[model samples]
Target: MTELTIVANIHAKPDQTGLVKTELLKLIPVTRKEPGCLRYDLHLDNDDPAHFMFYETWESRGLWQDHINAPHLADYKAATEGAIAEFTLSEMSLIG
Candidate 1:
């Protein structure tokens, strides 16, 4: 099966950029160890520190769903509540 790709765009509140970044970065280490996780990378926009993105690849959509239901992910969401101004997630399929 083809890899399951996801792009998550995150925007932090003006004053909470640093905290948002911190929380997002913390997920990298743990997420990379999860089953079926092929890649989990976090990126920051050079022009806008408040803007962040995650590029991820999973073995399958079901595995990706498992990642979403993880306790750490839920904790991250709860911890970053109100700090994130916007979040957009795109599930992508390789075209080529």
Candidate 2:
């Protein structure tokens, strides 16, 4: 099976950018330790202070599903509830 990739974009409420980023960053270390996580990286938009994105790779779709339901992810969602203005997630398969 090929690895599963995810590109997630997050746009935070103007005033909550810093707080949202703090919560997002906390997920990195924990997510990296999960069973099927191949890569989990966070990036902040250079020109847009309130924009952030995550680039992730997983060993399989099943493992990625497990990750979505993980406790840490729930915590992150709860913590940033209304602080985020927009959130988009794209699932992709590598071409080569």
Candidate 3:
């Protein structure tokens, strides 16, 4: 299994931050139900609401790919369109 962790620092549009955050929060349940999805969590920076992080874990790369193709995920990307400034995704392998 390949573990993945994505830290997306989203610079949301001012005032629109709440909307974007709501949209981001919607992904949690959707992602958790996906095949091979171990965990899917969303967090907002206490000091900087514009900054958001998504910590996700999957069973494998293929499963992760499946998540990207999910309709809900697609909708999420579309819904959050102009509200986001940038998103950086990082994949990680857990060792312990």
Q: Which structure among the candidates has the greatest lDDT?
A: 2
**Candidate 3 residue lDDT tens string, 1-96:** 557655456778777788898888898887888888888878788898788888877888888888889999899889988888777888878877
Per-residue lDDT for 27-62 in model 2, tens only? Answer: 999999999999999999999999999999999999
Against the true structure, candidate 1 reaches a TM-score of 0.97
Candidate 1, residue 5: how far the Cα is off, in Å? 0.5
lDDT of 2: 0.97
Give me the overall lDDT of model 3.
0.81
The C-alpha stretches of model 2 lying farther than 4 A from their native spots are: none
Clashes of 2: 0
Once fitted onto the true fold, the runs of candidate 1 whose alpha carbons sit more than 4 angstroms away are: none
Model 2 residue 23 CA deviation (Å) reads 0.1
Ranking by TM-score: 2, 1, 3
**Pairs with steric clashes in candidate 3:** none
Candidate 1 Cα RMSD after full superposition onto the native fold (Å):
0.7
Kindly indicate the candidate among 2 and 3 with the higher TM-score. 2
